[model samples]
Target chain A: SQTIHQWPATLVQPVGSPLSLECTVEGTSNPNLYWYRQAAGRGLQLLFYSVGIGQISSEVPQNLSASRPQDRQFILSSKKLLLSDSGFYLCAWSVLGGLETQYFGPGTRLLVL
Target chain B: AQTVTQSQPEMSVQEAETVTLSCTYDTSENNYYLFWYKQPPSRQMILVIRQEAYKQQNATENRFSVNFQKAAKSFSLKISDSQLGDTAMYFCALASGTYKYIFGTGTRLKVLA
Candidate 1:
């Protein structure tokens, strides 16, 4: 079965600090990866998505950026985090072709103080 | 670009009763997909049900089912015999061939004991 793993399940970062969240998927190869953020009591906001290694697409312009360093490894990073960057970040993976079902990771909750 | 809309911001239902959450979407693509994702208190995004644009039959998973009206661009979720465990933030999402997903603002459903 396919599974996604994300780390620093919970994070507390000071304002103006850097940020890095990692997501890795197992049991699948060449999967499309996505990054999403959700505010309190709000729906998900797509930040970035990648179709393959070194290929990334930004859905919204924000303080965050995404990179696909490997086939199943995706990373969300920021050089300078803002207070508005605080939220629950989710990483999802889906198979190529016609499959639209996305499997999400446990997620990382970041609080920028 | 596609957009999803969840008309109900919040909904409540007595346990063992049925509740329907409304979702509408706008898209110009012929082939696409719609999904209902449940985010429990644990904050994990779980796939409840999925409907393909080409299929006329609605998708069902145990107590969860969808009423997919392609022409009307409406996909509503009906939860039968709701339980407290069903309380969560439900998101309606639309995905086209672009490999990107557009999500609604989401609806919070609470099942009263």
Candidate 2:
């Protein structure tokens, strides 16, 4: 079975601080990875997605960026966090080259103060 | 461009009762996929059910099932014998063959004891 892992499960970052959230998947290779953000009581907003290493597509333009440094390893980063950047960040992975179901990680809750 | 719409922002139902959450999408492509995801209080995104555009039969998983109307562009989720554990934010999503998914704003389902 495939599983996705994300950390730090919860984060508290001061305004203007750097941000880094990591996601890794096991039991699958060359999977499609995605980053999404959800507000307090709102729908998910897609931030970025990667089909392969070094290839990323941004769904929305904002303070965040994503990178697929290795197959099955994806990272969401920001040079400086904004108050608006605080939310529940989710990482998901799906099978490659197909319309397979996406599996989500536990998620990272970032609180910016 | 593909878009998903969950008309209900919030819904409530008595435990053991059945509740249907409505969802509709817009897409120009004939071959695609639709999915329903549940975000529990634990904040983990769990795949509840999935429907392929090419298939006429609806998708079902245990107590959860989807009413997929391709011509109507509607894919509503019905939860039978709802439980408190079923309380969560349910999101509808559309994915084309290109591997890109567009999510609906989501509906908050509250199952009262």
Candidate 3:
């Protein structure tokens, strides 16, 4: 079975600090990767997605950016974090060209103070 | 452009009962996909059900089912014999000619024992 993993299950960052969240999928090849954010009691906002290595399509323009350094490894980064950048960060994956279902990781909770 | 709407902000149901969560979407594309995702207190996004715009038959998974009205652009999730484990925030999403999904504001469901 395929599984998605994310690092730093919980994070606390000060304002204006750097941010890096990692996501990787095991047991799948050529999978589509995505990054999403959800504020408390709010819906998810798509930040970025990658169809392949070194190819990323951003959905929202904000303080975050994404990069696919490897086939199954995706990274979401921010040079300087903002107070509004705090939320639940989710990483998801699906089969290449498979839009029917998306598998998500455990997620990272970032609290900016 | 695509948009998903979930009017219910919160709901509660007793265990062993049936509950339906409503979802509506707007899109110009004829061929697309709709999905329902569950986010538990753990904050992991889990795929509950999926429906293809071209499919007329409703999709069912165990105690979970969907009433997919393609022409009406409505997809509702029905949870039968609901259990306490079903307590979570449910999100409706749409994907149309895009690499990412557009999500609706979540409906928090609490299945009481």
Candidate 3, lDDT over the whole model: 0.92
As a whole number from 0 to 100, the lDDT of residue A9 in candidate 3 is: 97
DockQ of 3: 0.78
For candidate 3, give the docking quality class from DockQ: medium
Q: Which candidate leads the pack in TM-score?
A: 3
lDDT of 3 by residue, A1-113 (tens): 99999999999999999999999999999999999999988998888989999999988889798999899999999999999999999999988994647889999999999
Q: Which docking category, incorrect, acceptable, medium or high, applies to candidate 2?
A: medium
Model 2 chain B weakest 10-residue run by lDDT: B94-103
Query: How do the candidates score on chain B by TM-score?
Result: 0.98, 0.97, 0.98
- Give the per-residue lDDT digits (tens) of candidate 1, residues B1-113: 57899989999999999999999999999999999999999898999999999999999999999999999999999999999999999999998878778889989999999
Question: Which pairs in model 3 have colliding backbones?
Answer: none
Q: Is candidate 2 or candidate 3 better by DockQ?
A: 2
Which pairs clash inside model 1?
A: none
In candidate 2, what are the lDDT values of residues B16-72, reduced to their tens digit? 999999999999987899999999999999999999999998899999998988889
Residue A24 accuracy (lDDT) in model 1: 98
How much of the true A–B contact set does each candidate keep?
A: 0.59, 0.87, 0.79
C-alpha lDDT score of every prediction, in listed order: 0.93, 0.93, 0.92
lDDT of 2 by residue, A17-56 (tens): 9999999999998999999899998888878989999999
Q: Which stretches of candidate 1 lie over 4 Å from their true place?
A: none
